[model samples]
Target: MNFFSKETKTALQAKEAALQLAFAPVAFQATRALRNLGILKIISDAGRAGISLEDIVAQLTLSKYAVRVLLEAGLGIELLLVNDKKYTLSKMGYFIEYDELTRINMDFTQDICYRGMDHLEEALITGKPAGLRELGPWETIYPGLSLLPPDIGKSWFDFDHYYSDIAYPQVLPVVFASKPRQLLELGGNTGKWALACTGYDPDVQVTILDLPGQMGIATQKIKAAGLEHRVSFFTTDVLNENLPFPDGKFDAIWMSQFLDCFSEAQIIAILQRCMASLADGGRIYILEPFWDRQVFKSAAYCLQQTSLYFTAMANGNSQMYHSDDLIACITAAGLTVISQNDQMGMSYTLLQCVIK
Candidate 1:
């Protein structure tokens, strides 16, 4: 509040940042482990039963004392309750069950980030991933991803594909005035966005382009959506493969969460390819995370650092870019920025560019 003077505000912000710096990692690990324990209990109880401490010990293969400690801590955190020698999820814990956002966050922390955090020191030193330094990075992570059964990592992509699809109805009108045929959805997993877009415009032909494994999933999803007639899937490494389509083959291109994965040069290259592949004045819409200069010192900075750290660990490279950076990339690739809007109020920017 303005009632707090500027000096007080600055001091409070610094204090809060210090607290976050100290508490976030510990709290993150604790909550994630607790949530996993709760889920384990839920599943063990036929999905409708409460679990006793003994059950937790058996499921987690922990000593009785350790189980008690976990349960006590969990109860204190409101993830669990102590009642009649049994533990049950609290109402707040229901967010883990009922909210996709909560589940995705838990998954991200547990499956990807926790281990990556173990390598944070090495990452900071080399500006590369310690996990990759030891494990060969992208190659190891991607191929083994499908092999791992349905947990957070596998489910994350589903949410990614699904929520991006969910976002389309709201984003389309702002991004597109009239429908265009021949849509290319860059890095679209399982063709969700293509399906949504083609659903809105029956005449639109859609191609979903992504990595081979991702395209495999997209193919099945697109086929199941009954848009097979209008939609097709293409498995191509956008960075390595030559732009397969002829110049001006696409009327519109959609790249959601695609640019954030690349280095700056690669971003420029991809934008150039989009420019060449698009029809005259054809629009390209990009939805990617943003970290403007104004946000460089805000809580967004912490979020961005965490995102960057995980991305680097998982893939050896990732960057949170600003709208201006994107605009410059678009212009460098012979495209002009039409307009940009922050979607969902700064979660991401809906950026539109056209061939110059």
Candidate 2:
């Protein structure tokens, strides 16, 4: 199949876009300053009438000169509008200040990615997470999530939870559609999805499979939620081919925002393993943000840029995939796509597959 569609622009527009990319750092900092200095919130609170420059400086306790320069920079970035020497929040600026998705993305980019991204080139060349050294001594971020300094770990979890949590409510019903007696959750970080599964269907037994270190956290959450009996744990590297799933069969396997964390070969191995453990008529449900299936260019742009984060910080080999590419991997693993659910909450797509 041909590659999925993308928005295109003329040469002049593309040139302007290139210039914007070149100055992205300046814009990033300016946007942060607008929020940090209370400039954006102040204008947003003032409504359409806007707020005068003097009021912004006075409320923020900053020198007029500094405030003026920042406001001008904000204007250049299209985050603000100035009229009659008063400022108002632009659509982008309002979203920056208020939207949960924007806030989570901003904090994640600023706290987790900003510095590590500097080594993106080195990572791409070596095919390793070269930037991981900036945060901790680990081959990848997953193994060291618990050991990361408290603030850094919070940033990581916040970024991770924010994305999946928003989509879980909508995803829960879809996964329960088959009403399977036993459900196996792969990459069950922190046990949120497993907990949700048990909560969704009290009779359904869940076995969560992930690394031991990650299981440490997920186990705690399971116990805390009083789900220890319903939600079981299976700790494995997942890349280890020797030990796959348990002897017991699973009726439905759930992988939520998980496979994109691994390389293509790894994903295929994991799926092939699942195919071995799953009952003949069982299904595999995969929830992911496929860049090509996104409804908006901005969401797709975020997914593509997140691929760089994988290169530099998470794991070098894997990335957010387009639907066509990921489906190809599933087919290669001896699975057939039977149905799909897209636009669940935001950016997520659910693919339901069965044995080929």
Candidate 3:
């Protein structure tokens, strides 16, 4: 301790500073670029056979210098190795190939996040979105999504897949254990949640309501799961439209990961509709992201902000609102929160409310 003096402490601090610089994007983008160019795909496909820089350059029409530069950068990032004349992707570079659950990291990054990031300062200044109008024409972007590069489509689908897997399993027990007979899933994407519920209890009958474009996926999955009789799909624009079911039709109404896609007024209107649709003792189970002051200052918050921005741009108006605001809305809509739990690392909350 006596030998450790102020100068040594200062030197140690400098060492720590140098280590953090290794995680910078400049240090990683080279490997990412190579993966984007299909070099990684060639290496992954070749396996023990290996590949050469000449093969990559010939296959991709990239210049030799460019290929060398990318490989060297990948080497620097530990994603590649240069053995004599050949350059091959390293084991770590194979990670994406095994990412089966998939996430929309790249699509959100390219379609919405990268551009929204450029306008973060504007969003802070106005307390409003910056890239809604600037988001590329929806008519052009959405219809062509399936035709976009495979990586892009996988990225988009992966995002939903990740959230669904992570968030839905935690909720299955709660929904089933509640012992509800008839269920209504509002804006349930592709009927994944409905299938889970019906699978858990043969007695449970579920109806899923979602956008017209998403109904096909829901119906196909529901029918394939052999729950066609118990689970059904209803295509309706929930934001600017009325509930398709009459009052007291469902024993439980599930609004998983859906209510966050609207403004406060819209959430309140939806809650009112849910109240009317519920059987007297029927409950509404809501799952949504609930933010606080700390979340407002995080990079993760930027994702939510960008999501709301793009959603409003694409669908007219959608948003992420506070849970307290929602509780208030539920109360005002004549529903009582019987129980509420926050899960999925507090990015989402589940509330079981009954008509009061």
Candidate 4:
């Protein structure tokens, strides 16, 4: 069942894969152009009848050459099928054009990662987010997340929230199984989870611990929700080892897609802090899309590729971790993974841990 344990392609097939990689960027841009320029929509609207390059050009007010080149590239990318000088949308094209998940991933890639990815090699060499400079003057993306251009910021948050949002409803019951009165949510971006927690249980008091900028955004949402009395904010750089977590005994500490944003050592340090802050019988829950635990190969592939984005654009020291590696971090921090539930909403793994 190990999909990647052995080579399945013939030599010629492997060579073709190599060539695809060589021109992958060109293919990506061409596909984006086809979608953005309305070519894919026109062909999709044409249904089985398909649409001709001439018709596409006429409808879009683009030059014949421009439409033709992109349509031809679309053909090469297997996103289109041409017959009798007319183009039809392939299954892949349909997904690219209309699928919500695909749309979010495409927008995220284009708006947030495409240009910054050029510095990936430098980031690997320097152990720093060299590509982050493409976005703004920040050592890491977290601090500048709120300051990103509106469109870019939208794509980033959309990408971040899409996976976690799918898992929130499922995780709520798991976290509240103990009916804990106090919950601490780390990396509480925009306060979405905080809102979910407060809404799920009116009696549960939630504290969102995050950086100031993220706290600002979350604070607004908390106030707007009129849950200001039930929800509180704690702003600090989590990586500042000197500044330990605020003095409080939290009944449950929740980190959703948060630990993966830090290096292995940082994860251990953060987990240690969580241990220190836990009340009697308190537990820590970590929800992440650990690549190694994904049920589908496609999900694993997507997670693996997302790690590159972390290297180039997020914090270079962090990645979408393997399950084993992450578990090791927990053990190293003097915690025991009492329960691990995999295949949760959208290929995520929920690890329930207790102090050792």
Instruction: Report the Cα RMSD per candidate.
Output: 5.5, 2.2, 7.2, 0.9
TM-score, cand. 2 vs. native: 0.93
Using TM-score as the measure, name the better of candidate 1 and candidate 2.
2
Residue-level lDDT tens digits of model 3 in 1-356: 12223454477787875774665446545555776777778767766557787787778778889877877777766776667666655766666444432114544565544555555566546544554445543432333334445665555555545554567777878877868888888876657778778777889988887766667666888778777889877667675554455446788898866766665677778888777778767788887666541233442464455455544333334456556777887888778898877655334567888877
- Per-residue lDDT tens digits for candidate 2, residues 249-294, read 8999999889999999999999999988797689999999888877
lDDT for each residue of candidate 4 in 72-162, tens digit (9 for 90 to 100): 8999899999999889999999999999898889899998899999999999999999999999999999999999999999999999999
What TM-score does candidate 4 get on C-alpha atoms? 0.98
Question: Best candidate per TM-score, number?
Answer: 4
The lDDT values for all models are 0.65, 0.87, 0.65, 0.91
On lDDT, the stronger of 3 and 4 is 4
Q: How well does candidate 3 match the true structure in TM-score terms?
A: 0.67
Give the per-residue Cα lDDT of candidate 1 at 46: 35
lDDT at position 272, candidate 2 = 92
> Using Cα atoms with residue i matched to residue i, what is each candidate's TM-score against the true structure?
0.75, 0.93, 0.67, 0.98
Which residue ranges in model 1 land beyond 4 Å of their true spot? 1-26, 39-64, 71-99, 124-127, 132-148, 241-246, 292-306, 309-311, 344-346
Pitting candidate 1 against candidate 4, the one with the higher TM-score is 4
How many residue pairs clash in model 4?
Answer: 0
Candidate 2: C-alpha lDDT: 0.87
Which rank order by TM-score, best down to worst? 4, 2, 1, 3
Runs of candidate 3 with Cα error greater than 4 angstroms are 1-32, 39-61, 71-103, 111-155, 241-244, 291-313, 320-322, 344-347
For candidate 2, what is the total of clashing residue pairs?
0
Worst 10 residues of 3 by lDDT: 136-145
